[model samples]
Target: MFTGIIQAVGRVAAIERRGGDARLHIAGLPLADGKLGESIAVSGVCLTAVAFTPDGFVADVSAETLACTTLGDWTVGQAVNLERALAVGDRLGGHIVSGHVDGAGEVLSRRPDGRSERFTLRAPPALARYIAAKGSITVDGVSLTVNTVSGAEFGVNIVPHTLAHTSLDGLRAGGRVNLEVDLLARYLERLLLRADGGGVNLDLLAENGFLKQ
Candidate 1:
């Protein structure tokens, strides 16, 4: 698991296609203690390091990952948010991020908000139900709080620090981003699902204010 805090902004050094899959070599990651077979969050998608060098490492991306994320569109020198897996006793700086992209979203718009910037993004129809106002969501591997929700869209404020530290600085309208909704929300939906109608009901959730209307 990852904490969704970006440790470094690495660049795609090379991409070698192998049939439907591809191998990626990333540079600029400060992974001094990194080892082969270690999991790393590469722009919100957990990828394993198959080879390692002082300045970089290599990982394989499957065809499914390519179809689900922006990794397929990556090119040499493309900046990517990088984070090592959370270690024992490490501080949970941000919300728990599984580094599993649930779906991809499109940047709807971006505008200034004081020293920060407010970005609105449109989530996939299937993933929209998992997003909530004030809930945590990972966008392009950066964990952010949703300030507002409107149907399939939500807005988040990106502080200057986050903008400078990650690749989100390059975000623009019409751009696509990898999104991972809160893990709790995903599990909650599963808990409510039932084939025998024996699971928790909306009335119970509504009594606790979990559901509106």
Candidate 2:
């Protein structure tokens, strides 16, 4: 789990392919307190730290993750957003982010809005239904609120501070990004489906001790 608050900006120092999977060595991300096998959110995808390097860390990217996110397009020296896993007592600065990329999205446009940058992105059609106006969405591991929605297209404003602290500043029109919808939104959709006679109703929930009978 993560809060979607980027802790550091890193770069893909090296990439090594192993069959269908790939191993990435990241540089410039602070990991003095991280341990081996720890979970880290690398551009909205959860990757396990397999080794520690003098500069950064190494993580293995599975084939499924590559198919679902923009990580496969990464190359050496590519800037990336990095966020450590949320600790038990840490403050939830951003919304709950599972680092599970539902699908990839494309940057449609970018325009200056005062000190901020307004970006419009098009989400995957299958995941568009989960996006809502004012709802939180994680883009490339950075949590942002949807300003408006039109079908699969949504707009978000990135403040100057965010741009300076994360890798979002490098994005341009036509760029692809990893996207994760809000966690609660996923559960709400499931409950609504069950309510609409999906057969997984409250009776089943009670039977499984998920709710009081």
Candidate 3:
């Protein structure tokens, strides 16, 4: 698991196609402590490091990942958000992120708001229901709070620090980004799925002391 906190901004060094799959060579991130087979969150996608390089590491990207994310469209020298997996006792600076890209979202607009930038993005129609105002969402591996939600579109404010540290500063209208909805929200929806015609509800919450009596 990851905390959706970007530790470094890495660049794509090379992409080698192997039939339908591809091997990505990333650079500009310290990988001395990383071992082969360890997971790394690259732009919201959990990829296993298969080999180490002097600066970064190499990971194989499957066809499914290529089709579901912007990685396929990545070009050499493109900056990407990078985050190592969360340690056992590390501080949870950001929300829990699985590094699993649920789907891609498109940048609808980006405008300045004081010292920050407000971004409005359109999530995939199937994933829009999982987004809520004030809820947490991960875009391209950076966890952000939802400032507003309207249908498939949502807004987020990126402070100057975040903009300077991560690759999100390079976003523009019509750009695509990997998106992972809140982990809890996804699980909550699963819990509400009833196999026997009854599942979690207000009455169940009250009975279980999750609601005011």
**TM-score, each model?**
0.93, 0.91, 0.94
lDDT of each: 0.93, 0.93, 0.94
True-structure lDDT of candidate 2 = 0.93
Error of 1 at 204 (Å): 8.4
Please list the residue runs of candidate 1 whose C-alpha ends up more than 4 Å from where it truly belongs after superposition.
197-199, 202-213
What is residue 25's positional error in candidate 3, in angstroms?
0.4
Worst 10 residues of 2 by lDDT: 191-200
> How should the candidates be ordered by lDDT, best one leading?
3, 1, 2
Candidate 1, residue 66: the lDDT equals 97
Tens-place lDDT per residue, model 1, 68-126, is: 99898889999999999999999999999999999889999999999999999999999
Give the lowest summed-lDDT range of ten residues in model 3: 192-201
Error of 3 at 10 (Å): 0.6
Return the lDDT, model 3, position 59: 98
Q: What's the TM for model 3?
A: 0.94
Q: Give me the displacement of residue 129 in model 2, in angstroms.
A: 0.8
* Per-prediction CA RMSD (Å): 3.5, 3.6, 1.9
Q: What tens digits encode model 3's per-residue C-alpha lDDT throughout 68-170?
A: 9888899999899999999999999999999889999999999999999999999999999999999999999999999999999999999999999999999
lDDT of 1 at 151: 95
Q: Judged by lDDT relative to the true structure, which candidate is superior, 2 or 3?
A: 3
